[model samples]
Target chain A: MPRRSFELMETHIPSLRRYALVLLRHDEPLADDLVQDCLERAMSRWHLWRRPGNLRGWLFTILHNIYVNDVARAVARPDVVEIQDYFPAMAVPPNQADRIRLREVTAAIQELPDTQRQTLLLVTMEGFSYDETADITGVPIGTVMSRLSRAREKVRAASWGETRENGRRIT
Target chain B: MSDLPEIPTEDEIQALVDGRLDPARRAEVEAWLSENPDEAARVAELRDISGAVEQVYGHLLERPIPARFQNAAAPSMARSPVWRVAAMIVLVAMGAAGGWFANDAVGPGGDPNVNLARGAVKAHQMYAREVRHAVEVPASEEAHLVAWLSKRLDAPLRAPNLDVQGYRLVGGRLLPASDSGPAAQFMYEAESGERLTLYVEQNLTGGETAFRFTEYDDVSAFWWKDGPLAYVLIGRGGRDSLLTLARATYQELNP
Candidate 1:
């Protein structure tokens, strides 16, 4: 329990919060709660963390597990909030048109399947390597790449006014 | 060179957009893109998607981490509800001792300056003892350090010159304030190896307070609110000497 370890872990909290917010589709309170849970779990299991291991990836693995568990629990309940209801409060950006585009992009990301969305965010937004993303998501490297590709394609299509419905791509 | 394909695979194209390709492969992809305008446009679209994703979510990194999450690593306080309640009672008692009359003074989401000071002290204790990695950005890059921290905290910040007091700038790191914002911690060290840290955060309550002192174990902190920000100077020195440093820091920052 050296102080250095705590300090190092603290450095990663902002990134953790960022990942959590995206994973939970910008539900700030729920995201913070998940991060708190992840950190507490990490602290209790600090001994399992090898000294030279990638701590960021380790924390993400823990967070992804907790999120999956929470999703499972929520699916059992009847009053689950619709994922569409959690769009971020639009912070005022300098440009009006850019804000609209940004909102569309965010919505498109939200429309992705859970696995695809997780892979896309971890690689594109959080800047994790493909190997690290696969490790964190517990998928093979090829699966990670395919998920990311599909996610990006869907987002691109959404922006261009194309949508996929009932196994058919439509414009 | 022989391994280079005539047309990049989808993964390789995605990697090209992500800037993950090695130089030789990247050059090969760019050469192909130059010949294939349609494929190049698709690559551009992929790049735009990533950029938009970052644009949509990047500000979360700047937001202050909540108070509860800040202590997630503390062993005694991690999961126990009883300890959390006890911790709240202790905070309220400390607020009363400090003569703050408002019920929320130092309570959860109450007076943020008190929480700021506590955060400052915690950061000092955690980082000041380090021989290396003491600060995220070192004093040699003082301009970049100031600009980066100021941007994160959303306030213009000045690292006070403590040269006259024999402590030089050791650099600074951005910390999560107990409230919903970022705090900046600038570390300084004397020739004798004694270290001090100056913590700054955006003032939530605009009401300015005169300098107040607090001690936690061996470390002492002098904190106050000035114009747009709150300040805390933490050190292990005696009161008068640390006060001298605090006053010097205050003047440097305000002026």
Candidate 2:
């Protein structure tokens, strides 16, 4: 590992954590564990990690992969999360209604199909662009957009306490 | 005559949000958003969702690096593959510990400390390249500088003299090194505008303690361990000059 590579990893650590936290859901220990694992992979692979003009995106790809890899996820979940709680945005004005709505979003994410969940988290949760989403999830670009669209529709419908019929959400 | 307005389909709205739409479709979505305030509001809501997710989970990204990762996987320093392709993954420069020379990617020998020196040398090279603020303590204050560094490393030493080789101390600094402890760097410059740096850290505990060299592009690095400290000299100077500097460093520090 070149000296700069570790620097790169350090700079990217926070962004990696943001993505992990969403998946791990304020589960500090597990989220931290996952981020650490991702960094180790990132430092080792930093050479092949052509900036591709997006180091942040590349890191999210590593993190998301680790999250979904069955063995690793199994290892990550058991000791880290305690029922996956809410992080209710600090500035949310502390309204019961707002908290309820936030629950809808997280719950919808949890209910999303794996493809939709990962894609939504990568795009919406991790701030990766659609193109980078494909790179991270190893899915087609169309798939990333479609999954995001489906995920959003599900969240909105779920938010309204409604149902989604195929792609259409009944409000 | 016309009571209905053209609305970009939901797909087009998604394409717009995804930034995947062509300029023509994008213009159409803008026109739609302008006409339908309600839909535009929803789009803003969704973007907020994206931002919120980043907010909630992004904290992990911002938190202190966990300690467990510092002591994570310890692969063998030697890679003699059960699979042949694992060779490509070894770092391009392994320093004295199978660095750039060994292409073994997947095995049980990837040492974190090996990555440590690589991290320091790379930091030295970068900060040294900056002319305006090359070092926190310019070599002009060798005494106070030595006192400061000695306190950090918990050791007694001055900037080892390199004037014998036409290189004078540019300055020194104490930096948070790899996953290990702190590191001390003594940078030098020759009259001809060439620069070299000796990055040193002591008592490397569980890392590979060997003498190795790696060349990345025009830069050459010579790394070795002497007694209780590890040193790497980074420079673009020829092998002979760089090696002489490394030896001078060893003699000055050890003798």
Candidate 3:
């Protein structure tokens, strides 16, 4: 492919990262690396281009494979996130506390079970259609629905000061 | 007092919020949701998770798209001499009506080798030529410098003695790796703006050493490796001077 094709790849990166960040939550930098690896593979395998119906879907499939492989590799060699490896230049901005609270919510979301979080973020953050979520998660459409429903319930229960019992909202 | 089915059917209604339902199913779901206010309310809350999720992951969004990413899609990674040289081939490859790029590396956050080199070069340029802010820790205390940088990088390191090259050891600092991993830039300056820097980081791609001199516009960089660790020496000087700086850097770093 020409340079323009590479440019197209560049354009789609944010969406790809939005998806990858949620999949491999917390270790966002690692997610960036994973996304890079996937793109490089896609570049080299440009010949493997059959022009699938959904190009974005195919790319995400590659990303998914890469993340799964990385998670496997990480088992033997743990990747610890060291926060103080670098010093910050910017002073904490006004309402930095809001960001901290946001980070807490994010952390809480990260703490959600992998399945639930993935389902919620895929259907929510990325705004993937349920079919796309099912395809990305490799689950049946019905399963995707249940997982997302449960994910929403769980996150709301924990974060919104509410709970569900007997399939009904308490408040 | 109710005859309840096995499943509450909220799952189906939630799927409707997700836009999973086909026409008939969707219509049915909306009707069901209309009657079930409580289920509808919970779905609404869950639906808002989208914005919350964006807030969580969006810090990175607000963070300036680092120059690395910008540089990649910018003119260089987008259009390089290599690309210019291979234009004929790449065009023919494209002319055949071709390509669905994974858009992974090239994608929104996928900054390429050019950007990576630019990052390495920018760091080297920024630190090496610096005087007052040159080193976070001046080279007077080599022990503390080595200890601190080594501890950060989690590897033994020695700021190579470039005194022979007239580039005295100014000092070194632990800098954020544009992406991840720890990055250290050793700064040195002669009587001129002729500063040289050795930028090192853990293998990002885990690929073999990309031992090539890449010039993104005017800035020149020579990158190589000794195994897993990747090294990029960036400076504006001529090739010979750069080689001298690189050799001294490699020898000191190795020995």
Ranking by TM-score: 1, 3, 2
Q: Tell me the tens digit of each residue's lDDT in model 3 across B1-255.
A: 133222337666676666666786666666666777877776776665655565445444334333233323222211111211111111111111111122234432455344455567668766665557888888788789889888887767667777755777677888777467788887777777567677777656666542456554345666765555667777765543464455446556554
Candidate 2 off by > 4 Å: A51-53, A71-89, A162-171, B1-9, B18-27, B33-48, B51-61, B67-255
Q: Give stretches of model 3 more than 4 Å off.
A: A22-28, A71-105, A161-171, B1-10, B22-24, B54-255
Q: Which window of ten consecutive residues has the lowest lDDT sum in model 3 chain B?
A: B89-98
TM-score of chain A of each: 0.80, 0.78, 0.70
Model 1 lDDT tens row, A10-61 = 8889999999877766556556656776776787778889879999999999
Provide i-RMS per model in Å: 6.9, 7.5, 9.7
Score each candidate by Cα lDDT. Answer: 0.74, 0.62, 0.58
Residues B188-209 of candidate 1: C-alpha lDDT, one tens digit per residue: 9999999999999888888766
Give me the overall lDDT of model 1.
Answer: 0.74
Please tell me the TM-score of chain B in candidate 1 relative to the true structure's chain B: 0.58
The residue ranges of model 1 lying beyond 4 angstroms of the native Cα positions read A2-4, A72-94, A162-171, B1-5, B76-255
Task: Encode model 2's per-residue lDDT on A22-63: one tens digit a residue.
Answer: 565455545665665566566656666875568887777777
**Model 1 compared with the native: what TM-score?**
0.53
Ranking by DockQ: 1, 2, 3
Q: How many backbone clashes does candidate 3 have?
A: 8
